[model samples]
Target: MRTKSPWLLFAAIFGASFLCWKLALEPHARSSGELERAPATAQVDVPPAPRATAPARADATPSAAPTEHALPPSKQRVRVVVRLAADASAVAALGAELLRVDERGREHAVACCNDPLAPAPVGPRELAELLRAQRALPEQREATQRFELAEGGRYAIAWHAWRHVPGTLTWRTARGAGEVFELRSPFTCEERTLELVIAPEQLSLDPALDAPVIDAVTHVTAKDG
Candidate 1:
């Protein structure tokens, strides 16, 4: 028998090697590429969540202004003292009132005869060039506490006018005709006692030529707080 050629044997070996690479090595490389690409495409997208925060704070309440008038009221006593010019002449009072004064010296009616509890007008008054500017209140009716006395021989009479808060206050009285009289000085609310002194000249005729004239109105005090 003749021996096989060396060249044919080499060709047969190369052919078998090419077949194994195509069937096994190429198929495994394709499968690995598909697996890697599948993992990347299957990922899902998600959104981030929001953060929490606190709300703002506010004030509890607002402030207010002061009020008028006082609390826990008290009573006031009034006394009247009159002097006659002579035995023949006489003196008496028709009505009386109490007035409260402010820093501007403006007068406010605290008590009146017709309406004893009338409140003072609330507002600024027109300014004038007087030591104490007297302002006219709206629909302002003349007020009095109550003064009923006769021109009898009696020299004085004592009565009560009720509550009178003592800040800067004075008394007003009707002299005779349309005459109006006020106390000389303002009084504090301490003792709250007002003693009105009427002179003889105010009630009757004038005194003698040489006689000295006295004050028209005056008030006496006991003690103060």
Candidate 2:
């Protein structure tokens, strides 16, 4: 008799294994309906369905959205313009000081500027401009300062000016009777503008040329929306 081939023996073992696996999966596939059959009777297992969650309580409350009213007060930009009038051709910038006042009638010097003042030399054309504007002397515009002011804050401006005589083209560094513009401001709101003018006629300046009076017209406006 001829001996069995090694290839024939391997084929017999594979056929027996395939038959055992088919018999074991057929019973579970029919009863549970979980295992699915694909092409050529390939088995595929299916997972169980997820459980349902319980409903929320009827007494539960929802969250609310934020509003603009919850924001803090914003700061405002403050601009102060100062102008001086005299017959002099040139004037030196004596520096201006800004004061921040507390609620208890106390003042604090905050900001200051030493920028040079502008000069207006007199001439035939300048005379015409002065005559057209109905002014006795050419107005000397000085440097401006900007600061950030808070809401519901109090402030004052104390400026120093050098002494100069009217109709004289000379400007000296000798300072005279300089006064402070004490302000009880109502800047609680950000929508306020002020224009304060102190002319020659409004003040009784010193007769002596050594001590000239401080004449200033300050215009402050809020630069905020």
Error of 1 at 17 (Å): 99
| Clash pairs (backbone) in predicted model 1 | 112-144, 113-144, 166-189
TM-score of each model, paired residue for residue: 0.22, 0.32
Q: Tens digits of per-residue lDDT for model 2 on 13-90? A: 998877887877654336435344332311111112122132211111112222234443354344544433342222
lDDT of 2 at 20: 85
Off by over 4 Å in 2: 1-74, 85-91, 94-96, 112-139, 165-194, 201-225
lDDT of 1 at 50: 23
**Deviation in Å, model 1, residue 70 alpha carbon:** 16
Report the number of clashing residue pairs per model: 3, 0
